[model samples]
Target: MITEESIQQFSKNCENIFTQIRRDVIGQQEVVEGTVIAMIAGGNVLLEGVPGVGKTRLVRTLGRVFDMPFSRIQFTPDLMPADVTGTNIIVKGEDGNSQFQFQPGPIFSNIVLADEINRATPKTQSALLEAMQEHTVTVMGVSRKMKEPFFVLATQNPIEQDGTYPLPEAQMDRFMFNLIVPNPGLDELMAIVNMTQKTMAEVAEPVCSGEELLKMRETANQVPVAEEVMRYAMTLCSATHPNSDCASEAAKKYVRLGASPRAGQALISAAKVKALMNGRFNVAYSDVNALAAPVLRHRMKLNFEAIADRVAPDAIVKMIVEEVGTRFGLNPKKEEAAAKAESKKGLFSGKKA
Candidate 1:
């Protein structure tokens, strides 16, 4: 029976993990925080950024902070599925008999950093699909279970497209969040320089173990969500589908394929972690809205018109959020008006409504 006290402890553990990660990572708070949320929610993350934006450093730091087995697979054009997963090798037994032994690959670790994941062929990338979703890997017709609390924090270079294989729709949906790591601000750049210029490099200290992380995941799942809020999450997901009744104009006009049921599951699961992080006992509509872009961005596929007009997935999701509103108690139009009123009140009273 997890209680509010346990939830608070989980939140504290999250903060501790964050603090340790910040010791090494200079900028990209959103990336770090989103990664933390996804990890605690027992979901994988896809990070898109240009080279040298601390994407790999963030994963390495997280590995140290959590004190888990971390493996890095530098995906390349020639990387094979067997390289990502493991393959059987012949080993000589004590009795001088040769037998096949299953050699585990990097995917079997607690934390896996699939660096430049797009560099790998689609066939090789598909090897991770089962591992990311089911926490198990199949090789040579035999299925092997991964260690508990397995997380695949994959990174891809958005600027490089030549000779790179684009992730299929199904592969994209396996990730819980698709976060974009932006270039650091001037101050952050200066801080990065100062931090790295020193002869001594900072190393993240372990604040939590793998067991504690699994416990946090369990606690996050125990957080309750109200029926209205769950419905709001579902409605937001359905609105992404152009054919759905709740579809927004942007979705109906621009989107070709909407998010799947996994999107709804991700919404609620991540919202629970978000609420717990904010020290709330129950999920909130704001949590769902805040996570909408990352959760749905990769899940949606735009049409030809959207591609011609240069409509990004984030922009489409934004329009849908505007159509759905924050409260969802009243109609979207009325809810939008009410939200504006609340914002004005918060602005005037120095307190949010």
Candidate 2:
């Protein structure tokens, strides 16, 4: 059960985390918040942006804020699976006899920064599938569990596609949120430059630990979701599938592939955390709507028509939210005001007659 005291503590911990992150990161508040939400929800994040947008910096800052063992894997085409998951090497034993010993790679860390993940080949990329989902790495038919509060914060360049490989759907589905890191504005840019001038090192201190982060995840799991809100969340996810019974018009027209069942799971899980962050004890429709874009964007596959027409996934998600919200009567207060205005209009027409 979740107590009020626990909820207050969760919010305070989150505030402290953000305060520490701000010391290193300047802008891109939405991306930062979404990354934090996914981390607390015990899910992986896929960050898409152009070069030099603080994607790598955000992951580094998070490692410091969480006070976890951090490792950086600069993904490239030449990178191999063995380089990431490590391999068994022959070593001399005490008696001078050679024996096989396992050497763990950078994946065996609390927080891993896979910078420019798309630069790696599909074969190399597949190496992370098991670790991201099962939180274990299998090498030579042996499995090793990841450390507590494990997270993989991967980044990819969106504009450079010359040698980059697209992330497969199976791998894409493993991510909880695919956040876009937009460039900072004029003022934020100035602030970043000024801050960097002082020191190139990350100055943020650790405010949360691996154990505390796991506790936060446990607390978020206890935040209750009303039946109607739960159904609505499922409906929104279902609407993404054009072939589903609850398909929205936008999905029917633009989407080629809808989000998987994992999307619904992620939606509710993240919404619970969002509610707790807002000091609410229960999940609400607004929380689901606010998170729909980040949760569903990368999971969705836009049709060729959408691509040719330059209709981005974010725009399609927005349209789907509005369509579903209207059908579900998401806001009763607005509906009541509209009904009252219609009644007054009818009365005025009767007086004119």
Please list the residue runs of candidate 2 whose C-alpha ends up more than 4 Å from where it truly belongs after superposition: 331-353
**Model 1 vs. true fold: TM:** 0.92
What's the residue-level lDDT of 279 in candidate 1?
58
What digit string (tens of lDDT, one per residue) describes model 2 on residues 30-78? 7887899899999999999889989999999898999789999999999
Candidate 1: residue pairs that collide = none
CA lDDT of every candidate: 0.85, 0.88
Clashing pairs counted in every model: 0, 0
Candidate 1 off by > 4 Å: 326-353
TM-score: model 2 vs. ground truth: 0.93
- Candidate 1, residues 79-165: lDDT per residue as tens digits? 999998989999999999999999988898999999999999999999999999999999999999999889999999999889899
